[model samples]
Target: MTELQDTGLRRRADDAAPSITDLIDEETVQSIAQEAWSALVGEDEFLVPLPGDLPEDAVSSWVDVRGPWNGTVVITTGRSTAEQLSRELLKEHAPPVLDEEDIEDGLGELANVVGGNVKAVLPGPSALGLPVVGDAPVAGPDTCRVDLLWRGQSLTISVQGTAGALLDQ
Candidate 1:
């Protein structure tokens, strides 16, 4: 091969694959979560950035983003926290007793909004999948997570690469 071609190849090889840190930071993630919280969970509700112990019965909701960056935006919180959040989202419309489905749907929509905003900041032209609620996927190497507290309840938001580390382009 010509020396010019070899040099071009080397340059491409030197570029590292994009990780979560390369695209967004924890502060940015926290900001995105805060926006979602203020919009949906009530204008008065705010997410504190302090780290806290998550309850054993924590529940998670997430949405997948596929494109230059492939990962899931996951939101996790304790069961009672989730219920309170759902009620807050519904405001006076919430029933006297919140059911499991209500909690899941409310949290799922929160994930959708946060994930959509998160996707906008990432290397884009990406597609966002519907939100899923349950256990969160195990965090991978190229992951960005933010610990938060709402009403003094522990919650977390994680952006994890589904395909592990991104390989060189």
Candidate 2:
């Protein structure tokens, strides 16, 4: 191959970080969240594909995925909704009154479950990081986000590529 052609190929290879939109879609993300909610929260629970106003005090949980498509799978909702979700997730095992740690752990677990499933469908040989609770990482231009309502409360799930990764692309 000519030197110019080889240089072009190398540049293309170096700028090949995959976008989340290319790997997944809103419907797929909602389906994943629905399945997770049904299994973890309750079989009767449903996630309505309708957006509602998120309360001012919102909390976020996420898990980082490292691979050809590096990004985070994040879930954000109001604190009250998160607490309700925690109660539902714990069900019979939930304490009479949950503390902050319990709430965070529950949200984090949900993120982990959804993140694991998201990783499975992405390019092979990826690593999923442990769940985190707090403000979510900034999302880049290439993101697939699903907005839904669970029990009339707003919730969102986002598969977003890291800013740095997208910048490289």
Clashing pairs in 1: none
Please report, as a residue range, the 10-residue window in candidate 2 with the lowest summed lDDT: 1-10
Worst 10 residues of 1 by lDDT: 1-10
Can you give the TM-score per candidate against the true fold?
0.83, 0.83
Off by over 4 Å in 1: 1-19, 162-169
User: What would the TM-score be for candidate 1 when compared with the true structure?
Assistant: 0.83
Query: lDDT tens digits, residues 64-119, model 2?
Result: 98876778899999999999999999999999999999999999999999999888
RMSD of each: 7.5, 7.7
Per-residue C-alpha lDDT of model 1 across residues 75-151, encoded as one tens digit per residue = 99998998998999999999999999999999999999999998887654888999899987664554778899899
Q: Each prediction's Cα lDDT score?
A: 0.82, 0.83
